[model samples]
Target: MVEQQQSDDNQKNSEPGVKNSIKKLKNKFVPGFQYTLIIATGFNISMLVIGCLNVHKCPVNKNIPLFLIATGAIGIISKFTTYVRTRFSKHIQVVYFETSLYSVESIFFFLGSYWVYKYYKPSYDPTDGDVYCNKTAYLLAFIYLTFLYSLLLVMIFGCCCAFCCLLCLGSGEDTSKAGCKYSLLVAAICNFAMLVIGCLNVHKCPVNEKIPLYLIATGAIGLVSKFVSYFRRRISAHVQVVFFETSLYSVEAAFFFLGTFWVYKEYKPSFDPDEKDYCNETAYMFAFVHLTIYYCFIVFVAFVCCCIVCVAICVSATADTGVKYTLIIAAALNISVLVVGCLNVHKCPVNKNIPLFLIAVGGIGLMSKFISYIRERLSELVTVAHLESSLYSAEVVFCFLGSYWVFKEYQPSYDPFDETKYCNKTAYLFAFSYLIIHYTIALAVLLACCCFTLCCMICTYKVRTCCQDMVSVEQENDTGIQYTLITAAIFNFAMLVVGSLNVHKCPVNKNIPLFLIAIGAIGLVSKFVSYIRDRLSKHVRVSYIESALYSVETIFFFLGTYWVYKEFKPSYNPLDRTKYCNKTAYLFAFIYLTVHYTILIAMIFGCCCFVCCAMWMAKAENSRSYDVESQPTNTEAREALTTNDESEAKP
Candidate 1:
């Protein structure tokens, strides 16, 4: 009896342990899904690039590549959310973001499918003169969709088999419970049937319209019945509710079957663009794509329901190593950016600003990531400031500026006739849209910052009290100085990138941008090294080196600023490109010079104030010493009077 009791206690203790292990395993599945999704995004970006390269070929339908870019952008955001959730233990906001992305992506995928598959047999060769799409682009999209559908079917079949086995092993009560859930099965079946009817009658003019209306009514009634059953718990299990659900499903299924038969019997394709016939190719193609996706979604839902146990065991082994995966994703994205930019340059060499912008951003991003990796690996031996965020912030500013320019001066036209006059629409749109997304995000962040600042000002006392509790005064000062240096370094790096891109464009004073680039590079190195030295004083001693670098930077900045001002042109004439300097490059050079001068002036003003304060303190100290020396002491006066009295007595 004692041994039996001990065994029971052990089992009780192990139950919670088992439950916890299972919970952890379930939690890991989402990250695995995230990893898979990110990998898929890389493929999507590749397809977008291919489509962009062939944009001149598919002039009418830019939607394919546009959709790919849209999905890729959303995927990046989703990956970011996954990283944040994993890093911070934040769940609720991540869920909301994920759900929103999923819904938007679903709509985008359906529309893309409609557009891509509509031209079922488009000519592969450009010379064919038919509705042609690039063979590579078209095949990639087609294969992806085909594989997706096949996987859905397989998952659905596997789930059905699993469910049957479960039913066989289940007790009588379990079977009874399963029977009670027949309403759900009937609802799913009816939904599938409606989908088929919709697809069949999609191109049938009058009948197509009526079929959707019927489906909507059936869906509404089913939703209402389910809600009624849910709210009335006492009657949820009643015979009336079950009978009503069954009758509703049966009516919808029967109506859909009849519509399908009618459409199948009378179907005839109309090829004339202007004619209205029984079967419209356009409408049928659209409906067919949407309904097919809907069918896949149904199968997916059923698979999820039946394979919950399998999903629990589907946790990725690398889920815990999110940082490495994130780095990989970043690297892949940067490489794609570079490739796309290079392709754009190769296609249209007239406007190199936007392509070079892509190249610069991608290059800097990759460099920053490499530096971060090195810092992390050599964390014990060498200390490097976390400047990745600062670099990215600078990239955002440049992207916003570049996008503004693209929108104003270089917007591409979708007209096929204008292809020769403008850049490839696909490449131009990809760069423009990519930059615009970053621009919008940056704007939102700026607005949020402004709002938060306003709120802090209004609640200054509360903010101050909270900040005092969280951080020390010294820590606050250190953080401020550190960030200031980082900001300076980032600006210098930006100057280098912009200046190098524009250096070749200057006609007479080509050295202007080059000078700025050299000074900016020196200043950047100085600031970075100074920050490192300050942070790790024991390991690094570069005070004199930093001072010399800054001195040279100051001299070079003055010379560069003068050259830029002297050579600046206020107007740009695109037709006379040979005589005049590129206005865009000159403008950036001027901007960088002006900003650098402003910073230099501020620093000089601060140094003068420090000198004046120090001089005043010294003069005050000297005067106090002189006054003390000039004054007579009480003991000295008493001794002088005593001496006088003794002399008078002697006389």
Candidate 2:
């Protein structure tokens, strides 16, 4: 009786993944995850039924059943597969069949994306009666379907690939392997087929549409799959080589952006000119067309390649084959980019600084993991954390001294404690102060972080060799300890990734952190220079003209201020400088002045003092009094005085 009961339970457990999947798959024959499939089918049916009755009255020739029930049939099949898998345990046999089905569907989707282009050719003249086609609709549906599979296939193929590679995704942790495997298989097959179909669609012609709807459909599947698969992570791997290779497409996008302004920039240079003489520019335009197509193909191929590589890593790592270099490489790329940003931000000439925030953002993920790793090591006070934190404190002094010396020598405004007058960027001073404090603490912690990582890596290496149990979440839970460890870990982690990417992308192949500091250093230097300029200027308070006279230095001061603000906003409040009134209030006043000036220019008594001065100078240079020595200044003439000094000279 116990044996029979055990058998029943085993059967029951397998049903959800396998049997339900079959049911879902069957239901798909009628309906699926997306309602659009049915809606599309219905619309096609309506068009078919309606068009037949009034085929003669139709504005232009159109396809009837070309998009009707048959189109919907494919979706129904897909849904049925999903439902069936949910009902039972997926055996390898069930998974194999599911994979096959999705693979078949992927092919049909590719064909559909381009089917209309061949049929509905266009004519320039309306009199030609050349039937027009909404190739867009077909492409849209194809893309929708293809990606839908991509989402499903990621898991399915991941499993297949994992099984082939690692022998299994999980040796024992995985349950419901029955129907689940089949669902996974279906998903994989869908992804594989979509990749294939997407590639085919890249060649579909989309001229009149002036858009690559078909190509978009192919690419959208992978992107959508990625998004859905991610949630869509309960959801879904070598994101590096994949994303990097895919960046080739980004180059395409870059070219596209450039072409809008630089018509000649491209993978294959093309021309765009007067339509009257198409030949001259046609070659150029044709090249752009080919390049665009190439990019589309690259996008599709990369999506699949990325998925495959990521999965391969997971499988290899899980199987203990030591295939972790790609992960490291990805980590490296992220860091490199961030470093590049840091360096370029500082190195690039003011007003043309590369955006660093965007580059650093990509490393956030690596940062998180790094922090987790650090938390593991630093949780114990007796560890390297204490020594490193202290060391950071010492580095703070040197960092500040270096910055101070550079500023005082280069920037005449290098007063850390002195009150600043109007026009001084108070916020910048505050940022420097805050940076002094934070950098001290951060350096200490990061120093600890670096030590901890190296030590941990050494230990991890040993542990891996010994085949010992790895640390789990339960290993470190102390909040205070966790905080110190995590922060240090995060900082270090970011550093590691930055370092691993060979620090090439950051500052675009330069040391970003150093670059930021250098930039701040330069800005600090300029501040002092600006202060000296202020002291030397005739007007103690220089406004518009003085600001212009001291343009280069003045601009550099503001650029430095901006860098401090952008790079260190969290370290200090710009308004607290006590330097030039409140930073916020000062900026507000400047803004108000600008607005007022704008309004004045729009009105009449409207001539701004600046504009008036310009006009006055222009007129004065060519006046009738040109040869008259000091020709009784204009005021004397206006006063009707004998163009002389006061009648009663001073005694």
Best lDDT goes to which candidate?
A: 1
Candidate 2 regions with alpha-carbon error over 4 angstroms: 1-64, 67-70, 88-129, 132-215, 232-269, 275-651
lDDT of 2 by residue, 189-261 (tens): 5434434543443333222222233223333343333333322123223122222222222222322322322
What are the lDDT scores of the predictions, listed in order?
0.55, 0.38
Error of 1 at 339 (Å): 56
Instruction: For model 1, give the 10-residue run with minimal summed lDDT.
Output: 243-252
Q: Candidate 1: list runs displaced more than 4 Å.
A: 1-4, 16-35, 87-95, 154-184, 199-468, 471-651
Query: On residues 581-600, what C-alpha lDDT tens digit does candidate 1 reach at each position?
Result: 66766777778767755764
What RMSD does each model have against the real structure? 28.3, 37.5
Total backbone collisions, model 2: 87
Residue 89 in model 2: lDDT: 38
